[model samples]
Target: MDLYRNIPRKDKLLSLFNDDYAKTILNYAIDQELSNLRKLIADNKIHKIDEQLLIKNIDKRYNELISGSLKRVVNATGIVLHTNLGRAPLSEDFIHNIKDIVSRYSNLEYDLEKGVRGERYHHVVEYLKIITNCEDALVVNNNAAAVFLINNTFNKGKKVIISRGELVEIGGSFRIPEVIANSGAILKEVGTTNKTKISDYENAIDEDTTMIIKIHKSNYAIIGFTDEVPYREIPKIAQKFGLLSYCDLGSGSIIPGIGCNEPTLSEIYNYGYDLVSCSGDKLFGSVQAGIIIGKKKLIEKLKKNQLLRMLRVDKITLSLLQETLKAYLTDSYNNIRSVNLLGTPLTDLLKKAKKLKRILNRHLSDYFDFETKEITSYTGGGSCPMHEIKSYAVICKSKKIDINKIENFLRKYHIPVIIRLVDNKIVLDVRTIFEDEFVLIKDALVWATNQLS
Candidate 1:
């Protein structure tokens, strides 16, 4: 008690916040840290934290304040589109191309030929047209922004009929009805959660009806006795009534079978949708952006919307999305991390699991048990929740470390290995684990188990 009472004043503690840390964090961080140290002394179990220990603790606090809030971690969890690990990994080409854009000032809004103000979306529009076969294209900050802009543009103060089954909220609690309502659009949900027919949509239509929306349930699935109108059918009925039809292809799949198995943009456009929107990051394997493809007149209308200016994608997003589309046009999509990973064969995944198991055995034979187990890897990022890629994983059972400790040990590495605890065992799925990252996993295992060995 005397030791804790004799502790330095709060001002003395605040003084320890040096130039290494931001000015804002100095006082609060120092007070919190010193308060903890004092509590330890008050408890008397920690003995007495000497002046040297206090100084050292404050330095640690400084490091914590300055450290980046985000970390680069290895995805051993088998969720390829792991949302937390920054979703899709960029291809080497995108990275290489982005260097020049990041390093130098770009003609982001400058027309080189016209010597005048140009649209930033021009960088990606031509490629989007080529790939999607749409009359025109537009991009915005995110899919929500795209949806908000679309609904707000045409359907505000008007009725937009949508299926009850398709009223989905993605990862961030961004709900369809909420977005529609916020855009000042009236949402007229028809039919039941499991069955919504084209007739139901047709019945909802009147003078107030401006657009019919089909939201593809990307993140979840409701199986058994579920019947809903096809995306083509809704748009067909909309066209009959002279109403606009839009499809929110949530996964934004470009490749037919690669991601989520959602219909491609070309398929949607060719099916006669007036407007279709999708995500650039989810299935496109690029940075986060929303791509809208449809009739030229509709896109031009979107461009003219005042909301377009507020929701426009920046130069970096344009450059990355443009390069990603180019890769698709050139048939170099296999070079993309997400595409290649999703396209990996089950046989290849099994081989990777076995190889990783063998490597772990060789390095950590004494302290752990390494075995290959049959597992199913998820096509994550709210793309295809029901669709799974059956694969194999390496399960590690440590002789000394508990299951949670094993995970913590991996996290202690310079590049942490994020694993999954399945059936009371730690699993490392090699589906997203490329050939190069294997060695790092091995090294992490060795370092983590060194004490036990």
Candidate 2:
């Protein structure tokens, strides 16, 4: 029989699509099952139909479909602010703080004192002001929204003079020029790519210029003979022309130890910036959001602007951000996960690596090469581009299964183990991995070795 003739039609495969099979996997689309069954029929013959195997395949497909693609993976990359694995995992205790808040209704927008509607940002603004010493503060969905609000609220159809060197591309391909242009503002880039002076900004200012903006190159660094004006210098020039001054601290820095040289929010405010914007998920170690703090008048303009309504944060985001901010006011070292993870001392990491080595070497020694070595982790999420987090990694390699095979096998485990492969070796950075999760790592490696053998 011809190959196409052997393939079953929908009506022909009705037995499998009946009440038991179809209803069992109602969560998953049957179309995929049809495609796979048809291919199987074509590969074999009509007489070779495997009902039991088909049902087994259906069960596997159903499990994959029900468990959404975004399954939680263990971050062994050692990057504290890993962008892919949900940058800055909130501390379990901090999440517990907001569980009751999210479980029931609270005064999100209602003012209990006067029996009137209150502002959503009122939840975090006072805390933000207290921390940064800003006159006023507001919260948006993310830092990009804060940047867009600045441009849309103040510089619509007007010019925003910025240094060419400071024109940065944030994560997910969102560029500075694109954000400004999309916000209904004009981008008047000044200075050269490697050099921009206070005079460069001063020279670009004209009657059309509404603000002088500076963007932190959060993800990249340029060294050797590069000249840039102080963050304070740009706003000083803007003040001379009666213009607003804003700085988008891309991966918002509140802690000094996380990203080595990134300026703190308080330090940036002290530098005379009229408005400062930051992301909550980055170094703030909270939810994904933009925090804007500045003079009361400027913030009021953003709050009252119609654009704010479009870019405003929801109740849950506001609540989570409020709790995350509370972490900073208290003991940030104990509260924030990224702060503790990134700030994990080299001595501590060495201790962890030794402990991991003892566990893994006992089980994985036969199948793989196990050695403890000093490794470098990054401050990911485009915060500290090439800066290294000195740490220790259990460097693993197998003679039977290559690094690619090891990586693929580890991913198939119940809790996916994400490891970094550098220098033709499988590196498991133990900084981000919890001590409790070590059992899963052991099981995965054992299973992988058995399968390969």
Candidate 3:
């Protein structure tokens, strides 16, 4: 048939997707072929072009493009927890545990006590309760989910009072108001954007006020002539109205230091937030999950909520979070890659950058200008939005090579290296890049030199 003639003689494409799968590919392939066929008809080359050959060629191209890996260029760009680069890199130990749990039959919901069905969240529940010193705890897929679960459980059909300044729009336009609305909680603005006081909440109090929520401005800071309420003062206010005080500590930090006055989960609970929700990924440096920790009475109510089971984390998340919490409990801060990077000293980072520069210069000395300079690295992924840590970078100037082109090529390479540009020169910040990635950077520089010359 004329249509059969358009199929190309490519065995690779033929074998890759068999009849059923190939049929799906063929529809789009044929649509693409239709455009080419139209051109052939217009050029009077319809008879010269084999119809089957055309289909096969298009299918070959389609097959080549369809792969499982979600490959994309990462211009690390000096953002430490670059959210696009999968936020924090999973620690080696965490990665191993993930593989072991995911690959086999885990005790995700199988209770060994009576050989009965178990709860998936039980994996991290005890750890969170112990570490945070909370009476009970729960976890979900992400912080947003945790917030929703808490609100739906406690504050539904009631008012959730929050400072206007604290109502932030998280990454991807996930605004605080929107989340509260979705959770069936009415967002009652308490005070001015930058200056909210205790009186604001006191005046806004009403019978419908089910909870007084304090949303931590974790990602950013409101400074200069700013007056805010503290956790210590909040419990009294909530107690006055018999309202549950919940704190959504987005990007909650466990490790202290670096000037952010944000309290840890334990601190918040101690200071008197009845319930607190934080992210597992951001400051905790674990997988993408939401951790809700608070009083047992409230948590037990949340646990009994049907929506809790719907938004509960899977076995893999449970396992990774459980192990990640253990690392926190043991004070093995190094086990969490993001926390470790944040805690590294400026002197140590400069020394490492100097070492990386020396290794790279040994290979590309003649090709590029190499110099180590002091820079500031961010605790990105919306963790420490306003804080900047002093860091060092090996700034390289490529001779006659297009800076953008060089950057594009480097980004396209396997296991891409993210670099920054200073004064039109390519700069690699060693703060975010670990010691092991140093050799990889050196190799990439060598490859870039080859591309230039």
TM per prediction = 0.92, 0.93, 0.86
Question: Is 1 or 3 the stronger prediction by TM-score?
Answer: 1
lDDT tens digits, residue span 205-313, model 2: 8899899888888888878889998887877888889998999887788877565778898889988899999988988788999889899999898888998888888
The 10-residue segment of model 3 with minimum total lDDT is: 67-76
Q: Give lDDT for model 1.
A: 0.85
Q: Which one wins by lDDT: 1 or 3? A: 1
Candidate 2 TM-score, C-alpha based: 0.93
Assess the local accuracy of residue 133 in candidate 3 as a C-alpha lDDT between 0 and 100.
80
Runs of candidate 2 exceeding 4 Å displacement: 2-28, 35-54
Best by lDDT: 1
Query: Listing every candidate in turn, what is its Cα RMSD in Å to the true structure after a full C-alpha superposition?
Result: 2.7, 2.7, 4.5
Error in Å for residue 406 of model 2: 1.0
lDDT of each: 0.85, 0.83, 0.78
Give the Å error, residue 96, model 1.
1.9
- Give model 3's clash tally: 14
